[model samples]
Target: MTFKSLLGGAALSFALALPVLAEENPAIEQRQGQFKLYVHNFGVMGGMAQGRMEYDADMAQTAADNLFHLTRHDQSRLWPEGTDSMSVDGTRASPAIWDDLDDFVTKFAALQDAAEGLQAVAGDGLDAMRAGFGPVGQACQACHESYRDEAS
Candidate 1:
């Protein structure tokens, strides 16, 4: 029932679920690939935040670093104009993304800031990790709530 044990299991599960073959759209393939990574790291950090797993400073810091780096990359190429969920069969990208790209980019900026903030404090201690985790989680929620479809 420890977090490390659960994280190991979750990592195995996520590893199996990772897609290897290309999707119909290259953008979808790449986007989903990137998101799978995000999900895995975020899951580890979340486990620590929730006390669902024992906190390992190394693991927490590693996950925070991964998330922070991932957000730093330019993902603009992954979201083409016509690839919204309404048009694509394999993605949850909402049409709203194309409608207001500025807001979407701003949300990603928030995520980058939050992830960077978490990276700074994750290895400090349980209390620091717990404290810094909030904004990152909230940033993710904000973007998902606005630009991702729940239908997937």
Candidate 2:
């Protein structure tokens, strides 16, 4: 092939690879930010649920309900149809998530269950509410240990 044609082909190939090469996309950034926000809210709600800080029953229940709703919504959107080659802050979500999709789904489903249970029990009373909070905290830690950035 002519040198000019070869150069043109090479340029085209490079351009095609640009998206992957950048390792950053606005959509990914936005999603990552949303996930971080979810984590923060979860932590805050969990703290209240655990009685780490003083919080009224109504406030605790509201937080728990919000956390449960957001977690389910975010998980559905983030894991849609299985994804690979998506990482935020160096979290290489293990391939098992897609390979063993059923297992991942089960684990996340358990998390949802815990979150919902926490919400249901949140306004019951402080001691009973704290009892319910344990599982929800465990669920977050379980997913994070497996799927998220440990450093973060």
Candidate 3:
């Protein structure tokens, strides 16, 4: 392999190993994993919406349900205090989250509401998917704008 590729591989390996190497908090890892799960399901619906992937009814419904399902969990354990971006090495959770958790939860409730709407129309058609996904996307953006790191 070329030197650039070799170096790139090493960099990737190091990035993937960052939590273990840094001895970071487990709550950070858990919450990050939960967000990754959100991305995985949301990416599927987003791909269909963007025409990057062929729209399939079953996949759309499943992805929408899974995304909404994530919203139903308690999620308290994943967000322990001292795990904000200011205090943690690898987290992107903003300090603002702890500043007013009730408001933060209200934002999350908006996501839940929007995701439920998306799940309702997920299998209807691409146009419906587009319409439904817009609110869900907006909900996520609203929360991220307030409580997520730009780099995250």
Candidate 4:
């Protein structure tokens, strides 16, 4: 091939790679926002279950069940290969999570365990539900402290 043709082909290949490179940095805002929503719902249900708020056994149980589902949802989508930090619009997720992936995975699994524990006792009564709240809350706080933004 002529030098000019080879050079043009190489340039075209590089341009084509840009989109793939961009995809490597997936947006994390949606994931973070979902987590925030989950936290809000969790608080609402937990409050009711603890009698800190008006009790509605049905609503509280539904919320607890949803929380368990959210915890079990695939979380890896939030972090892409070779990605350490993700910026979606203005929200920031620290790269420390990818750097310490094992720790991140462990915390996530712990959170799931806690959520499941809460779910298992959700139908028994408020006292039974309250028994699992502390560990679950701690799991969330631990992961947020390590991976999420401070404001989060």
Q: Which candidate's TM-score is highest?
A: 1
Each prediction's whole-model lDDT (CA): 0.89, 0.67, 0.87, 0.73
Q: Report the poorest 10 consecutive residues by lDDT, candidate 2.
A: 80-89
Give the CA lDDT, 0 to 100, for residue 133 in model 4: 68
Question: Per-candidate TM vs. native?
Answer: 0.83, 0.69, 0.82, 0.72
Say which candidate scores most in lDDT.
Answer: 1
Off by over 4 Å in 3: 1-23
TM-score of 1: 0.83
Order of quality (lDDT) = 1, 3, 4, 2
Model 1 clash tally? Answer: 2
Q: Give one digit per residue, the lDDT tens place, for model 1 in 37-141.
A: 999999998887888999999999999999999998889899987778877677888999999999999999999999999999999999999888999889989
Comparing 2 and 3 on TM-score, the stronger one: 3
Model 2 C-alpha lDDT per residue in residues 1-152, reported as the tens digit of each score? 99999999999999756533113544444556656766776666667665687767887777778777866774455553323444333334554576677877777888889988988888887877787788977886786676553332
Instruction: Tell me how many clashing residue pairs each candidate has.
Output: 2, 0, 0, 1
lDDT string, candidate 4, 1-152, tens digits? 99999999999999755433323344455476677878787888667756789866677677778899988888767666533344322344676877788998999899999999987876667777677667788898899899876542
- Model 4, position 135, has a per-residue lDDT of 76
